[model samples]
Target: MEKKPSRSTEDRGISRARFLAGAAALGLAGAALPATGAQAAADTRTGRPGRGLTRRGVVYTVGAGETPGTAWDPARMRADIRAVRRDLHADTVDVTGDGVERLTATAAEAAERGLHVWLQPTLGDAPQREILEHLAECGRFAERLRRHGASVELSVGCEFWLFVPGIVPGETAQERIENLQTGTADPEQVQRRLTAFTARAAAVGRSVFDGRLSYAAAQDDEVDWTLFDVVGIDYYSYHQDPADYVRELRRYLRWGKPLAITEFGTCTYAGAPQAGGMGWSVVDYDKDPPEIKGGLVRSEHTQAAYLTDLLAVFESMGLYAAMAFEFLTADAPHLADDPLHDLDMASYAITKPVRDRPGDPASPWHWEPKEAFHALSRRYARAAC
Candidate 1:
């Protein structure tokens, strides 16, 4: 992997000024920063509502097979995770699933190697009953892991906001179906469901390990700062400048909850002439660049640079933890394609042609580490200490 270029003197000068400005605003200017874990946690949670638990370091994730299959070779998965740990000096990995069996096994594997595990549950397109059942199942799994002396740092419902009603205006029944299919729903209803699910999860946590429990919100709007132990947001800057992205992040910081960049990435698709902005283009990755049948272009160095800048800002802001969107995949390029692109369904994907061609599993973007991944690993390695 290539090393991230060192910041120029001028860039460093600007960063120093920004840092000082932020410090002064936060009233930390000229104060001796807490050096120990207990003090650090206290500093972070003093005025905050929930228990103060600062993340040990940055966390990253990789998806297993789309559905359960031998496609998720345990040895290969372990090797990839081990390589990432060595490269980034990271100590945590996130594994997502419907229940705890797979997650428990994965966590056990990670623990043998001394890495912390963050478990994420995919709350499929089930109604309230199913969602609740899934949460209960996760609680049981969490208890099992705790019994084995493993700790779970976070529990996420991958994309709950995408299923809520009225979050985005759906003009027709097709649009409505598409919205629900993608899990986009009204923000208020999202809050209700989130509150209920989290409260239930909390009850489970009390029965299990004494560590923290948190949910990964799809976007800032989906985040109920008051309800969650940590404030989690996804940062994909392909559509917006890094500065503007950080500006949006400021809102969550005010809630005083430790923040996590739960998911962040750029799509391969470039902006469309008719597309309103970069944000819209990224959000609808399967739609722009009309000439490409699948809608996505190959990932670019520009995307990597954007990620580098975004991480720098997060570090400067003193964020609690951050995780990249994903690692390797059995579905490779188009794992996120179906619900993202299906135009007949509501067209969230920037690319068209939802599925990859038969036998050729390479995603439109493929799995080779882009400049962004390399840049991210280098930054994370340096930040780990």
Candidate 2:
């Protein structure tokens, strides 16, 4: 897999200290609890107290079988989904992957566990027709789940500009990203293509799915939210004031639709929080077994703080849903004894999958929760009640 370019504050030409200072000047709270609680009392959108973040969830990925640690086993998928509800205290689960069957089955398992299902099919680097077909099939399954009393929503696609081919004249996601960065790809043309494709996706989803429709847009992707029921964005905050998120996200409110932070969370490393969405790029995948680039320090505390801080922001804004980027990256296992090989430091998962321990006699895989897991459990437990 190619390294995703970082969307850090520095990348956006904003100095961290300057942005922080500006945010403080704007009276944004630096603390997690107090300011958010106060903001929740009066939603900026309505000038009244709004229901803040009704759905708390995590992204659960079931990779295609091409990978070694794909969640292909039905029993294991069930157990993982059960943990999302029982252990994490999340009310929703965003099931994302490429395989139509795997995505449907895992979403069903989450629904069975009484978790709201956000069926997101990510068919990266595939033909447009194939991607639409995958989404159509998933949509059909989602409608069935909804008819069966499951709370389900179908996200037709995510980051389609990079994932879907011919959008920006690149063969791969990385190349397309680079092309956009270097000015080789025209932004207006990309938006035109993205707009057309998103309309088609929404039409296909509406054709087969009767439930609410959404799309997990890339942080910078321009989307026509009027086509969908929910305004969802994969928001990743760099070293900016929480108030910055409110100011920027407030624009989406113009559509008068509920907003969802579809993807947010940082890797477990000292500086990972500052890296934001591109934190995972720390891994050098060119090697046979990918290894963490040198000099990065592992810090579970940083990851925990990053998540709660963002949750506070979302709560203050009275967002509808906030799904952490992931539950676990099975392929990125933790090697406690080997710093260079500790891939978990690059994963956004709250659970740390053991390197040598795939599972015990009772299960096919095993993982231990990081500090973020406990922090999220406490917050979600309180919010759900």
Candidate 3:
């Protein structure tokens, strides 16, 4: 399988001084208690504090089967949610993937576990002519999940200029990624096309789905929030100043709608946090058989610390909701003890998994929990207390 290019919008590599500065900024007190899930704190479209609502959740990446060559197992998925609720103590889940069946099943189980659901069904490299076909699938999924009586928020799509076909100068996201990496794509045209499609998506989305709506945008655009409910941004930290990441983010809150960090997470490696979104790829995908770069070391701590600091930032800013980029990337599994074959070194999952092996017999999960898992559990559990 051809490895896709990086999803990061900027080079997130940070200085050691900055990392230490962030660590200092976050003292023990930040982790001692839960973030102010204040009833008076804003958590809705109007920016008014909803009664007891701070969307604490993880992005449940659709189904277990979807993870590279890992056999599809619905049983494993249900078991995973049980752990998400029990271990992470998350109250919300942004379920994302391709199939309608996978999206609904995950949402249904999450709801049963007493968690709010955010359904994001993708159109995946669909052509300009297939926009309607894309929305139809989304409409069907959103409307059905709405009927389930779950506290659900439907995200129309994410980073459309890159993911959706023919929206940008390139034909596919792979092409657009190349154009973006090389700085050849037209920014103004990308913005115009994105906002235009967004308006149409919001209007059509409102007609089919009888509930609140949102879109996980890439770069900022003039979205017709008048047509939708909440403002969702797929923002990540990759800038020099810690304040800059927040500075760019604060602009979105001005929309006067409840905002969500639709996606965020650091990969597991020694320098992953410092590298930000670009950190996890220690392997050179350019090779025929991708190999983990020599000298790169794995450190669950880097991943954990980054998540802790960012979550604290989110809590301090009083953001309504956020979901880690994913729960697990089973396809990016551990390839024996060799650093070159360590696939987990390339993933963002809080749980480290081995691809071509049976899971641990002692544990119900196929993968072992990384340090980030414990850190996440403490953060969410402390908040609840």
Q: What is the C-alpha lDDT of each candidate?
A: 0.46, 0.75, 0.64
Q: What is the C-alpha RMSD of each candidate to the true structure, in Å?
A: 13.6, 7.6, 8.8
| Cα shift from native, residue 253, model 2 (Å) | 1.5
Instruction: Please list all clashing residue pairs in model 2, or write none if there are none.
Output: 358-365
Ranking of candidates on TM-score, top first = 2, 3, 1
Candidate 3 lDDT over residue span 191-301, tens digit each? 688778877777777777888888876444456667668888654454433344455567778779998888777777776655544544465656545567767788789
Model 1 misplaced regions, further than 4 Å:
1-70, 143-151, 163-209, 222-224, 237-241, 269-291, 294-299, 333-367
- Which residue pairs show collisions in model 3? 12-238, 34-383
Q: Is candidate 1 or 2 superior in TM-score? A: 2
Give the lowest summed-lDDT range of ten residues in model 3: 24-33
- Each model's TM-score? 0.61, 0.84, 0.79
Give a tens-digit lDDT track for model 1, residues 62-166.
333333331445665567566556764556676665444555556667666666777666544345456555666665666566667775665645434332223
What local lDDT score does residue 239 receive in model 3, on the 0 to 100 scale?
41
Candidate 3 regions off by >4 Å?
1-53, 63-68, 129-131, 182-184, 219-222, 238-245, 355-365
Tens-digit lDDT track of model 2 for 1-385: 2333223222222221122222222222122222223353334323232356878999987764324454467877888888899999999999987788789889988888899999999877778999999999999999999999999999998777767888887775656655765679887888899999999999999999999999987655678888999988876665445555566666667899989888888889998776655576677756646678867999999999889877876776778999997887775677787788887898888999774453222234478899999999988898777
Predicted structure with the largest lDDT when compared to the true one: 2
Winner on TM-score (1 vs 3): 3
